[model samples]
Target chain A: MVKEQAHTVSSYEQELDQVRGMLVRMGGIVESQMAMAMAAIVDRDEDAAMEASERDPQVDELEREVETLSIRLLALRAPMAGDLREIVAAMKISGDLERIGDCAASIARRTLRLDAGDARLSPGGLRTMGRLVQENLRRAIDAMSQQDSERAVEVWQSDAAVDELYTAMFRELVTYMMEDPRTIRSCTHLLFIAKNLERIGDHATNIAERVYFAATGEQLPVVRPRGLPVV
Target chain B: MVKEQAHTVSSYEQELDQVRGMLVRMGGIVESQMAMAMAAIVDRDEDAAMEASERDPQVDELEREVETLSIRLLALRAPMAGDLREIVAAMKISGDLERIGDCAASIARRTLRLDAGDARLSPGGLRTMGRLVQENLRRAIDAMSQQDSERAVEVWQSDAAVDELYTAMFRELVTYMMEDPRTIRSCTHLLFIAKNLERIGDHATNIAERVYFAATGEQLPVVRPRGLPVV
Candidate 1:
């Protein structure tokens, strides 16, 4: 009887570790989706956008698999305290990643919408903003995968800088519209692009919060940092 | 030992029920905030906006309390599959509600921003569009609170209507700005207001999904119904 109990315990532990490993893989897919989406925006590459859209299904499938595995573990293992937090955090983090995938897909759709129009963005500023947002998203996933609270804090700190860029972009787009009525159609698409990047920033912050919860077993009060309009 | 086990079981069940009740109450508060925020937009009432902003803290407090209760339940009860779902669902639903609160406060902030200017929205059509979107938000919440799947379906159907209104509003605002550069500032604020309403509608749909999940332990695939722009 003692041997049987030990065998079952070890098997369950192995299964839990497998779930964690799968989550990290899913995170990588989501991070790649985001980066490709940004590249499609900066390069105006419809093929890249299409590829990102197509890859979204795989992300969706992984999310569903993660949820199923977590639920199965809960039923079979009856995890308690810290183990339970790990499972629950896995579930929530998968959700954040799935939404990140959706945001990427949304960006791809916008790229398609702008395909027939003349590009309206100033190459330098928009590309810089896109790169910054993607880097923040990548760091956020890395932080979560490594369970590094300090790295998560770094992601959190960078949010204000992203917001500042968004505001500047917003002002520039508005000025463009004002300067030439002809720019309206293309500028609207640019607005959508900026908004998508802002949302990616929001999702990155969400991952940071989950990391904090997983490590501390407590939700840090979500304080909207000083610089941006609290959305 | 048998009697002691029975007492503990009953108390644990009671505690779980209390947590559920609190979540429902929090949902009510969030729903009310959405309504008032929309009202402020239509009436242009700063006081209503201020009230909505103030109520945000209450939602925040409720979310924190729900988190604590959920963790405690996991630690103390070691609930089985069904009870575990209920607790986890409560946590997720509260999160959705907190986001709804944030959306409401966002609208309120825009309301305050609008008050500093006299930019009037095109009177008749824009008002009708605003009313339709607000009605959809209210019905969505009602369906969620009552667990009325039929009503939830109705809200889902109305989403296309809101999108149509948004497109029309977009065209009208763009025309107004093109016709007179003077209307630009006010039109920008109005644009933000419209976007905020659209987002509130999205949050309502999110809540409906949670309702579906809680009632049936299955994931609802997000189907983009036929009418809205894919972008």
Candidate 2:
């Protein structure tokens, strides 16, 4: 009977381990999608854009898988305390990761549109902003894997930097479009790509917030710092 | 013992009912926020925009409340099958509704920006698009309350119409910005507002999808029909 109980415990641990593995795989896919989308913009590579867009279905599949496993655990195991937090966090993080995938696909679609027009290179600020968001997302996922709420807080704080950079890029693009009306078409797409990247950063912060909440069983403040002012 | 069991069942029902009420309340707040945000743009009412933005904290608070309750119920009751779906659906729906609130706040901020410039009325198509999204969101919340998956599907199908309208509006605004550089700033704000409305419609569709999944115990196709090609 003792051996039987030990086996049950190990199997439960295995089930959770399966979910953790899937979450990491999903995060890796999203990271690649973001990279490919930005590369498509920076390099003007249509193939990269198509690949980024094509990868969304994989992300969606992983999100559904995570949801199924989390729900199964909730129903079957009736997890309490830390285990409950882990399963719920997995569910919420999967949803946020899926949104990041959609944002990447949105960026890829914009790159496709930019390809059809006169290629105005992404302003220098965009690449920098993209790198910031990418790093933040990477760290947030890492924090989730390690159950490190301190690292999650670090990722959350970094979002303000992304917002500041996005605002600067927004002003730069608006100025460019205003100066040369001919650039309006391409510039509009770039503005959207920038916004999508900023939103991806926001989703990363959201994941971090969930991780922190799961770890501490406390909610973060509803009002966060803002760098971009309207107008 | 039988009476105690009956009392326990009644308390469980009450707990679920409390969550249901909070979900609807959150949904109502989101709906009003969207309406006010659009009204701010249509009427150039800065006060309306500010009001809409201010309401977001309330929505955020309600989201936290719903999440806390849902997680507690999940850990304590181990609800199964349909009851489990209802709790999970409420949690997902609240998150989506909070996003819609954030999008509305985004639009409201843009309206404030538009007010700072030469007054430009929202293009004719924007109002039409706003109404369509509003109707879709309303129906989605109604479907959730009634557990009407068919109505949810109706809301899902209407998203394509919103997307088509958004593409037309996008092209129209881009042309306006190109024709006269003076319209660039104001038109950019309008563009963001339209995008926010389109996103609100997307959130409404997400709610519908969740409702359908909850009712049917089956996942929908990940690849949905999208009408707007960026080119």
Candidate 3:
């Protein structure tokens, strides 16, 4: 009986580990999608844009896989306490990752609309904001895979900078549009690209909170440490 | 043993029912938030905007409540098959409802920043989109409460109209900004407001899909019936 019980326990642990591995893999796909989307804008590479958009379906398929595995564990193992929290967190994290993919695809498609000849719109603010958001996303995914609550908290705190940069980008783009009416279309796309990056940052923060809560069994923070990321 | 098993089964059913009720309540709060947000933009009522934003915390609280109960159901009951689907779907639906609240609050906050004197921006397109979105949100909520897969499918189909109206609004606002540079800031706000409403519609579609899956034990349509809603 003891031997049988040990074997069952080992298999259960393996299943849990499988879920974690899936989440990490999904996170990696999203990270690459973000990189491609950013390159699409910064380099004006249409191929990168199309490639980023193409990866969205894979992210979505991964989300469904995570959902299925988590639900199977819930039904079969009846996980309690921290194990249960981790599974729930994995589910929510997958949702956030899917949204991040959506944001990347949205950004990529918007980049396609931007005029190639408009040397008028400076992507300086956008590039900075995108880089910061990318860093936060990376940290948040790492936190999830490592079960590192402290790293999750760190990612959560860094999101405020992304928000501030986004605000600055918003104002700068509005000024550009007001000054040159001809730049309105391209500038508006840039504004949304900035907003999409900010949203990606927000979703990353959400993943951090879920990761922290799963690792610690406590809510990360009631409100964002600084200015709330809003439209 | 049979009597005890029957008693346990009834209690499990009760718990599942409770989770469903909490989701319905959360859906109701989000619906009202959407209403207040639409009123804020259409009437330019700052008070309505504030009220809409204030209700966000309640939505967040309700989401936690649903999560707690569903997690409890999953861990304690070890529900199987249809019951398992119901609990998982409840958790996901609550997440979507929370996002809808977030979009509503976002629109309300942006409306707070709109210029009071710029009669230059027309809410006609927004008004149309908002109304369509509100109706769809209502139907989606109803579908969840009633467990009507047909109603859920209806909500799914109507989302295309919201997307279409949003595209039209996007073009109209971009044209407005290009024609009159002074309206650029307010029009940008209007653009986001339209986008937010469209996002809320997307969330409703998400909820509809979840509800359909829970009630019928199958995935909803893999792709939307119309244009993919991207920023």
Candidate 4:
């Protein structure tokens, strides 16, 4: 009986590991989607944009798989507080990751539209913003994999930089649109892409929070760093 | 023994009902927040904006309570297929609603910014967009309360209208800003508010999907209606 009980505990641990693995995998897909989407804009590659848009279904499928596995474990294992938090975090993080994929797809689609327009304006700080969000996303996923709250906190604190970069991009794009009505169509699309990237940064912070909560069994304080100050 | 079994079942049912009630309650708070935030923009009332921003903490508290209660039920009850879906749906819905509340608070902050600028542009279809989103949100909550998938489907289909309205408003605002550079600051804030409203519509659709999934064991068709087109 003791051996059987030990086997059961190990199975539960296996299930928990599976859920974590799925989340990290989903995060990887999201990161790739963002990178590809940004590449579409930077290189003006419509094919790359189309590829990024197509990749979203893969992210969505992974989210569904993660959710089903997490729910199955909840129903079957009846996890205690620590494992329970991790399972719940898996669900929440996958949801955020799915949204990030959507944002990437949106960016990709906007890039296609920008390419169709004749205004060949510089992307202006957008590449830098994309790099920052991508790094934050990577760190958040790394923290999740290692169960490192400190690493998660670092990713959480870095959202301000992404937001500041986004605000600057917003202003720059608006000026470009104002200077020449011809650029309005393409700049509007760029504006959406910038907003989407900002939102991806927010999602990274969200995943970091989930990691912190799962590891420490406590939510981080409500006082967080702010990038976009109220005007 | 039979009496004890009956009592346990009733208690589980009571817990399920409690989670649903909390979600609807949270939904109500979100709706009120959106309305007040829109009113702040419409009436140029900084007080209303501030009030909406302050109310967000209450929404956050309710979300925490709902999550705690749902997780406790999952751990203690180990619910089977139908009840498991409901519990999972409750968690997902609460997350979406909390985000909607955050979006409303963001709108409120942007409204305050707009008011401070003294440019005082006409809100320009923002009120109509607010009404559409509020109605969609109300229907989603009602569907959850009644377990009505048909109503959820209706809400799901209505998102396209919201997207079209948002696109129109985006163009109008851009034109206004281009016509007079002085209006740029206030118009930018309005643009954010409009985007926030569009996102709330998306959240309502997400909740509707959850309601449908909870009512039917099968997931909805992945080919769903979308409001914001790729472009």
> Which candidate leads in DockQ?
3
* Pairs in clash, predicted candidate 1: none
Interface RMSD of each: 2.4, 1.9, 1.4, 2.7
Candidate 1 versus truth, CA RMSD in Å, comes to 2.7
CA lDDT of each candidate?
A: 0.75, 0.87, 0.89, 0.85
- DockQ of predicted model 2: 0.65
Checking candidate 4 for backbone clashes, the offending pairs are: none
Residues B91-195 of candidate 2 have per-residue lDDT tens digits of 889999999999999888887776355565454688899999999999999999888999988988889899999998998999988888888888887888888
DockQ of every predicted complex = 0.46, 0.65, 0.76, 0.49
For each candidate, give its TM-score against the true structure: 0.90, 0.96, 0.96, 0.91
Misplaced by over 4 Å in model 1 are A115-120, B115-119, B122-158, B222-226
lDDT of 1 by residue, B82-164 (tens): 67766776777777778778777877777677534453666455567667766876776677656666776777667777777
What's each prediction's clash count? 0, 0, 0, 0
Over B1-231, each residue of candidate 3 has an lDDT whose tens digit, in order, gives 999999998998898888888888888889888989988888888898999999999989988888888878887888888888888888899999999999999999999888877644777888889999999999999999998999999999988888888898989999988877888989999999998988899999999998898888888756788764656
Q: List the candidates ranked by TM-score, beginning with the highest.
A: 2, 3, 4, 1
Between candidates 3 and 4, the DockQ winner: 3
Lowest lDDT block of 10, candidate 1 chain B:
B115-124
Please, what are the lDDT tens digits per residue for candidate 3 over residues A188-221? 8998899899999999999999999898888865
